[model samples]
Target: MKNKSLYLYSFNQRKGIFLLLLVMIFTQAIYFFWSSNTTPQKDKENHQWLALQSHVDSLKQVKEEFKPTIYPFNPNFISDVKGYRLGMSVEELDRLFAFRKQNKYVNSAKEFQSVTGVSDSLLAVISPYFKFPDWVNQPQKEYVKFENKISDVKPKTKIDINLATQEDLIKVYGIGPALSERILKQREVLGGFASMEQLAFVWGLNPDVIENVNKSFAVVSTSGIKKIKINDLSIKELSKFPYFNYTIAKEIVTYRSMKGDIQNIEDLTKINGFPVEKLKFIALYLEF
Candidate 1:
């Protein structure tokens, strides 16, 4: 009878135990539902972050593509892409290539134009940025300055050869009193010198003396000399001219007798050993 009473007493708390069990079951259900959602929520956040990151990267790439920047570069060393960027055509690039193949470089903007034949408008746009090496620019600058200064400087006073006095002629280093008189006599015989080159024909005036004469004297006033007809002159008469020797005069007379007339200096080139080099010089005093 005591054991039955104890069992009945234990059964009296069964409602409270069932309610506590229900509470535990509800907490476990809540915990499991939270756990199931946590990973997918984190994954969703990660996917959004990745999409944002990709969009930012694409924006950066577009910015980089559109950005315009140019740096000074040597035209001599330009590659195809660089040249294209500078607006050079294929033919212009090819010209630069061919010029470079000869181991030559474009030293100046002008030289670059001459080599590549770049249009003036395009050259105007790109030329300011063309950075040649220091050596390239320096020498050209110095030479140009030298030429400009030379041109800018006043010419020293000079006396015309035809009008120069004997005292003036003697001022040249090699010309003595006798040489000065000889030059004056020759000037008188010729009426006046047409060119300083005629000084070479002055008897006993060697090349050294001629060089000295050129320093102080110049044929500034061109005086016309009488031109002789090649057809009319005998070999003897032609040989008497300062330029023509006996053999050359004979050859000329023979060529004229056979060929009718030497139309120009070109016609004289056909004669054997006609001093073909001096044809132009000789042509100065000859009429056909």
Candidate 2:
């Protein structure tokens, strides 16, 4: 009886151990399945936050890329969208102007290039905006010869009578010292020659001098407009006429605006420092 009782206690201990191991395995498996399904939603939210963070980082990079660049004479910091942007290096401006003569219409880039006077090394920098304008640009034509080629030779070298002083007038073939003095005296009395044919008016200016000079010379045409509209002519062209500069040209326009149309040539006298006799000498070149 003592031996059977000892065997029964040992058997009970073994069974209790086996039952504890089975429960532990079952609990672990349940916990693993619960975590796998539940953790995915939290991971998805974390992934979305990471993507938003990437976009936010890109915003800072863009800001740095477009910082305002400075250039001489250009007060506004506005960047060029099509040609070049502000804040670009010296190389950028160089490329924009490189083909300027071939492509004249890229206004801002052309202006910048003119201002900066870029060199060859910097061309690659601004080449992105060096697009040629369609309106003004023609496809470069090859120099092909056709049978009826017109010569580009000048018609002839003409004496510029409009530019000649009294000394220069004497250089003409038939104008002697006496004739030149007579011409100058007549110019003083009559104010000026109204036409090239008026060379006959000089006391001793022979027909031969008039004929030779006419072949190489032309008088300024007066047949156009009897009155001048100041705003029509460019500043350089305006300055070519007697006693006019940028300030005077602008003043003429302002005066016309304030007073209305200039009806006669005498109206030019209204502007300050306008020499009436000098104007009469130059009137043939101007028109309304």
Q: Pick the candidate with the highest lDDT.
A: 1
What are the runs in model 2 whose C-alpha is more than 4 Å off?
1-23, 35-79, 85-122, 125-217, 220-288
C-alpha lDDT of all candidate models, in order: 0.80, 0.58
List model 2 lDDT by residue over 199-240, tens digit each: 755544556567866876675533332333464765565665
TM-score for candidate 2, please give it. Answer: 0.28
Clash pairs (backbone) in predicted model 1: none
lDDT of 1 by residue, 1-288 (tens): 976765674554867778899999999999999989998999999999999999999999999899457788888888998899888999999999999897677768999999999999999988988897543454322223344545578777778998999999977766777778988887776567767887776765767668868877887775556677887899998887766779988998899888788898788788777776556656777787
Alpha-carbon TM-score of each model against the true structure = 0.42, 0.28
